[model samples]
Target: MKLGELFQEIPMERVHRYAPERSLDLITNESKACRPGALYVAIPGQRVDGHWFLKEVLERGAEAAIVQHIDESLPLCQIEVPNSRRAWSALSAVYYGHPSRGMMVYGITATNGKTTISFMLDSILRGAHHKPGLIGTVKIRLGDELLAAQMTTPEAFVLQRYFREMADHGLDSCVMEVSSSALEQDRAADVAFDVVSFNNFSREHIDQHGSLEAYWQAKASLITQASSKSVAVINLDDARIRTLQGQSAASFLTYGIASKDADLLAVDLQVSGPTVSFTLLIPRPVYLAGVDRTVPAGAWPMKVGSPGQHTVANALACCAMALAGGIKPMDLAPGLLAYGGVERRFEVLYHGPFTILDDHFANQSNIRTTLSSLSQMDYNKLHICYAIRGNRGVIVNRENVAAMAPFFKDLRVGRFIATQTLGEVTEKDVVHDEERAAFLDEAVRCGLAPELIPPLDEAIEAVLDAADSGDLILLAGCQGMDLGAGKILTLLAQRHPEQKAKILWPLNDRVCGQTIPHPPNKKETQQ
Candidate 1:
């Protein structure tokens, strides 16, 4: 593929130079990974700029350099643009030969449930025999191989490269969680999605986005990016969905529990232990033209892997996406039944004398949903051991604490321990003690006596000791709760090896553990 052909959609001024004659073998970031005649994109990132290592990339046999500014002294062919990020995304799409164009891509953005929906979509697609690739917070999958992902979304160049790899690997469809920062920065600018799904938004990433409206705009951009022929699936149950509808150009498809006007709606919902079944109502018969017929404007029995009202909504969103993309409704039932769910989203680790839920509720909305889900489950006492990140934005932290407080007050729980993950970081430059104190005070005021433990390990131990048989032990947090959860699970297994048979890993699917990819010259640190 020629560089000239790749930048056709982009204006000529944005296209500084095109090396048509040069044949590139690969696209890379690390100098060592660069092969001869490879396109090296010099990204100016937090720690180090790729421009500083231009000589090394050239020495390792890169043919050209895509950069924001040119370094005339370098011997490599330089292509300068106003924004290197946008250029990288455009070039990657071309380099991958526009893999998304060959497949139905669904981009889902939200503060929570993004991972679960991605997994659901993957299972549904596989059941229908359409090979699906996934890219999100957990990992990236191109068919059977799983690649560890550092961020919820990767940089433009890396993302495009993965798309190309998926295309080569014979994936017919791709489902990804599009983060707000990724969209705001143009990481997904070049890719055209077949369906864009909006999950509920909340106050998150305020530190980077600066305001709630800006964060919403970043998420809304995904819907706007879709073509008119593409389908925009919005959750009518979410208040923010109204704002997104105004920004979308794609054909509208709505799903909700409360809204009767929704194109696809859930009715006759029933929640049993570890299984929630629902009836899906489609307004009209969906025809794929030559493909199979979906639901004939009637209710279809739908079963989700997890036991939560939120899961029911997530299934509805997945159904909307599948239906919009021409997937038959009959095919959805088998796929949905087979879905074990995504890891760490209200996962049950132990259920012997006591029940242990390993839930990752990072934001305010998620915290509320997880608590509400637990309330529905039968338990004598609900003992919650939660940790919050110190670096999270002030508004998010406040809202998360406030939302969680009401749930804690309602819980007939024996105990609730609210702790900080990172040991109090209070200094002249950073004062997080007050924020931490505020969260504890808020929880206590909500009717439950909340305690603040310095370290997460101690908090877990204290909570477990208080829990008895028929009681629930829940470890919920966004950061490094997995480590604590893993350790606790091991301890529980060793203490009650007989109960090991009862201890269930969330999702019921095993992911091969791998290190997340990092930029050049960066050190890997455990969070």
Candidate 2:
């Protein structure tokens, strides 16, 4: 691509030096990765500024540079931009042939359920016989190939590369999980989206975004900036998400279980052992993706293999986005029924005499949802092995414990086993004394009288020993609880030796958090 072509529509503050006809072989933000014919983008970051590395990148033979600040001493062709990150996104999209425009792109942004909804959309598109790709926290799917995902939303360059690969391979659509951080950094600024959903929001990433309003604004941008031709799926049940009403120019598709004005409502919902069945009541005419026509007012009985009120909400968002993209309503049931679900989002590991469930109970909202879903199930006893959140600040830990307090009283929780995961977590996730104190103090105030368990393995063992025939054990936490599933399953296999294969084989090939990608370099880490 020519240097002039890459800057076609990107706004620039000033052009320090121009090399319009220069043919660039590569584009990168990393100074270390610059080659002779490469274009380097200088991004200002929290700890390290790409501008500071200008001297290094130029010395490494970068042909030209995009910068927010012009350095007169560097003998380089520089295109000064108001915002380097946004320019990088725009340039990368252009360099990749604007691949997203050729496909039916679906973007899902929320505090939770993004991964499950992405997977649900992928299944729906595949059921309609349209080749689809997925970009989410669990994995990135480009046709039949699967790659480990480093974040909920990849950096702009990596994201564009994935879209380019998908488009070039003849894939017809993509379902991507857009994150708050990604939006704040303009990582997904230039991608074309056909359908965007703002499922729900809660207090999260406050520290990263510096405040709650900033975080909300970041998530809201996805819907507000959507094109008029696209569909914006909104969760009417959430008051915060409701504020987005009348804010977007795109067609609105509202969904909820309680809201009467919802365009799509889930009625007669039933939560059985491992399935959630609901009657999807479409109140009016809506676009059906698969049939390429409008679907009249109707109610369809839909069933998802994954059980929970939260799963029903996720399915509703999936149905709305799929229908908007031309998928027939008839295909929704099978697509959702076939979805096994993402790992650690109320994942069931054992269902024999007793039940074992694993979940990433990260924040207050997630805890409320997980516990509320468990309240609907029948069990002899509910044993909660909670791995105390670590390194996430005292306020977050206190709030998480507080969220569980009401559920503890309501569900008559059998036991609360808390673990610090002393040896299982990395240095960044290590539980500090203050965080532990906050959790304990909050639990005691809420009458949770939690028993302290040191290591994660011991916590799992304690839960297993306390489990009865009709008991339901929940292995819950964030990074600390990632290995909980495998540990508990191994313990179960030992206890019931004859059923080892049945206990472990089901999740043998499907488990996550085991695969480790190559360690990133310093520049890649900063991005």
Question: Which number leads on lDDT?
Answer: 2
lDDT string, candidate 1, 424-503, tens digits: 23331132776676666665666546777767668877888888988988887765464556656756767778766455
Residues 12-107 of candidate 2: C-alpha lDDT, one tens digit per residue? 778766888998767789899887778899998899999998989888888899999899887888999889889889998998889999999999
Alpha-carbon lDDT of model 2:
0.85
Cα TM-score per model: 0.85, 0.91
| TM-score computed on alpha carbons, candidate 1 | 0.85
Clash totals in order = 0, 5
The lDDT, on a scale of 0 to 1, for candidate 1 is: 0.75
